[model samples]
Target: MKAIEVRFAKEIDKSFVVFRETGKYFPCPWHYHPEYEFVLVTKSHGRRMVGDHIGYFDEGDLVLMGPNLPHVWVNDESFINGGAAYDADAIVIHFQENFLGKEFINIPEMETLKKILDLSRRGLVIQGSAREKIGKLMVKMMTMNGLQRLAALMSIFDLLSQSQELELLASPGYTPRQEDQLKGPTDRINEYIMLNFHREISLQEIAGVSNMAVTTFCNFFKNQYRCTFIEYLNQVRIGLACKLLANEQNKIVQVAYEVGFNNLGNFNRQFKKIKNMTPREYRKRLDTQLEEDSIFFNEAYIVNE
Candidate 1:
């Protein structure tokens, strides 16, 4: 077992407000919570590995995961790429069954809320009309406490539970797990890579970060993350590239270099490999879609990356 540092949020000692205004990031690393986590992505763009499924996530991404779900919010470097301050961050609210009351569901009073949380176990992603309506409730929760907090929570479930467009993050088994086992090297490796992904990072550097031999480090990381160390690094960089591509102000080749890809051909190839289109085409398609979806995701939505 690796010495994974975990800072767990305590069970709500009677439903209180939990608002986060952080120092450019989240508090805990890749750790799970006993309390359910409802995250509103304010301004992030990167991969979200929930349980075992992997996918790219960006702005306005709201996700809900069950108790003790192994997960993380991999923030792409593009947001902090010496650009204007969009304040790259996230707001996560954690609460336990006890906070909501253990018998709330058993009493039949919280039946609907129970259904919403049940749907969330499979993981629910709010989209379209419901996102705006339900998303506002999250922002409203920030300013609430006591009975008001309970009411806000109820409204959140009522709208989200009824939404048809809510997409399931994955089919299940997200990542098969045994409780006693601990998270190994991948979390530490990814944290280091995320902090220093701008330039070059070598195998020795990563191995040293893991405090292990190169061979052992390689096997440990591959087994945990389901990708070789190098592959994960490329994915992190490419995630940044996609953010840049979507941004529209930057040039294709500059984004290539900025995201740690040295050669233009290699960047184009990798970008096409992961994103399935040339950077230019990817940017074009995203811009077109953004225009079409302009009617959605306004300031009314409350999410911190």
Candidate 2:
């Protein structure tokens, strides 16, 4: 899709921007910005699209994306449709690479921080104990000011640089087209597919969107995405299916059809191929994980008491 470029409002006193957003749902569209971003979802569950990577995000989901990476978080239907009781909330931090001045990052002491910034170009999901520690630091930064806030940000970066619990989101081969180079044939094709993936899309239809012959379009898509067009479509569908599966209220069959799978057998096969587990198993695992987290929280609270 052609992502819109979003510019941030500059603050005269701060080198970075940190704020908590709360509403019926996240209101951002698919967009890109020049500032690297650190995001922590404090409430809501939804699908997050970062570059060509699609995944489910829940409360406590944290990610860092380098400058100009297209991304958005769309809350679940319940949140958006006013069926949920609580509002969606997130804490976000945005800063340019030179926010602290180019000289500061070029110094020998900042080598690891520079490396982590470079890795973030593909987007990174902070995981394990690092996620918890960094999330706390982010929350603390909301109340901090001046040098204190900057120090906390540096601490978060240091943790990210040394920690082994980082997962890259976008595919290694994926590169976001810059604004100057957008509106190309491939970009149109991507927009069409993403907008219409919930229904049957024919080869001729996609080829028309790309302004190419069917055979030529197939070859071009394979070369550009490192996979067949069908494979890419299935990846997008399965990604959305995952978010739907997270809510146990949705039946597996309904989720499959909702995500554009016309048949149960095909959905099962594709889900297993991409996720390494059947839909039922994936849902069961999510439940088990939630239960474990609740138990851990209760025990920790009791111990503190």
Candidate 3:
């Protein structure tokens, strides 16, 4: 058996970068990174699984993922089934908070900016009017260089720190260190399974993806993720199904088929096994979430495009 592995984000190479991708798959995965991340998904009609915060994300979704939190952006059936094309153009800033100096943010004048970075570690989504303001700054940061770039980053944080319209992504007690993420072939296998697991993926299929034999892949998968391949697959499917259950437009059978379970019976059994609740119960919880979410919605009304 091999040891477990986790990978953190490598946003550290530079202070910031603007990425533009078309049709290419983006799966940064559940790994955390060293730097704080400010990202806006301009396109992708998929659900966002940030830490424990789950929700339907259409185009123009603005989110701020804090340092070292488990999260991923999954392409839904539309992109997966239609082989649909989409783009993810984002501005990511990765820096050691006091890379400048301990005295930089410690000054009374910089208290607000310092506070924002502290809150950022737990991850947060910039919302309300600030969402638009931040989005503009994100785009603007791309055209900057030298001291200009650093200045813009500081201004962005200054604005974000004072804004009351932000949502935290992860809960308390969530610590993301870098060393835990650099796992072996397990990440490759998980990535492969996520892309293909939606279509009645077999052990042979997953094994082939791993470029290993069934006997070897099984042991490796368990050793790295601490779960059998099937267990991991079921978790992925069930996780998607949980998101789908919130949509009133989709049916249970539709969700079952959509999430990659060809058979409805198996979907139900597996959903129950992992969630300890039936599909309807899941829907019920979603409805409750919607009601609860209305409170947050009232507080922040920015994403209403």
Candidate 4:
């Protein structure tokens, strides 16, 4: 896959673009472009890569990615299965940073919005109360026109700026690389890791894939990604484990082995280090939240009917 992708949008009168997409999985590779993206995952669960950060995402996942931030979401097998039972969909909005004119954000009235846009350079996750509020607004915006749509977009950004649950992704000092000199090796390394993270991977083997010796590979990878190779691999494994744990039918021990952890102790330790909770506890929390959401949805359906 190309390291950087150039996306061309059809001519439209609006300053931004909004649309809904449904498919077995997100089709894009690990790629970046010049547009800032706001995405709300309405269905599906998967491992998402943003910059050098790898993590799990599920339904209601809301993320804002800045221009030239490489990102991709590789769906769990359940979502990729050719069945209606496990399809994915999202509402995606794309806009340029200066869509409202370069001087618009510098005004005192838009200080907060300006700050939010700056923070989005490393990507941001919009969560908690803001996710619910902004997500609904985005859905409505897809059906709106002219001033109404622009208002909805501003409202979403306002809520995001004030959100206490806003989380930053990627690391400081990481910038998108445009040189073809590094793109091939980086893409090869990423593809190799994603394909074989379910099995044991060695630094030497990965180094060979990057066509570097062990020591050179270590230095090169750290310089390029700002994270150790092992750290990246563990994140990928843990991300997959998260998707499996979301299914109540899977046991913790089963999920551990399924994602390349050989021992339950190591799995528990690494999972806690990355997710800050034990796998069982994480499952319980998700179960409780899901049940509550189900009840709320049923009541809403009855009221509407």
Per-residue alpha-carbon lDDT of candidate 4 for residues 83-129, written as tens digits (9 for 90 to 100): 54866899999988788999887888777666677767678888789
What is the Cα-based lDDT of residue 114 in candidate 3?
A: 60
Ranking by TM-score: 4, 2, 3, 1
Q: Mind giving the per-residue lDDT tens digits that candidate 2 earns over 152-263?
A: 9989988886776666777777675574334668779876776578788989999988889999999999988899999999998998898788777899999999888999
Best by TM-score: 4
Q: Rank the candidate models, highest lDDT first.
A: 2, 4, 3, 1
Model 4 residue 98 distance off true place after TM-score fit, in angstroms? 1.6
Q: Where is model 2 poorest over a 10-residue stretch in terms of lDDT?
A: 296-305
Best model number under lDDT: 2
Could you tell which candidate, 1 or 3, scores higher by TM-score? 3
Candidate 1 C-alpha lDDT tens digits along 1-305: 22232455454454633465444443355556566777777665666655544455766788877666666666665544535366666556676666656676656656645666765655667777777766677777777766787787777667765665655554444532445334456546756775567678999998998889999988888877798888888887887677667667788888888878888999888888888888888888887887555445332122211
* Tens digit per residue, CA lDDT, model 3, 62-168: 77665565666776776656576655444455555556776776888777656666666666777778888777776777677667777877777777766777666
Clashing pairs in 2: none
Worst 10 residues of 1 by lDDT: 296-305
Write down the lDDT of every candidate, Cα atoms only: 0.66, 0.85, 0.67, 0.81
Clashes of each: 6, 0, 8, 0
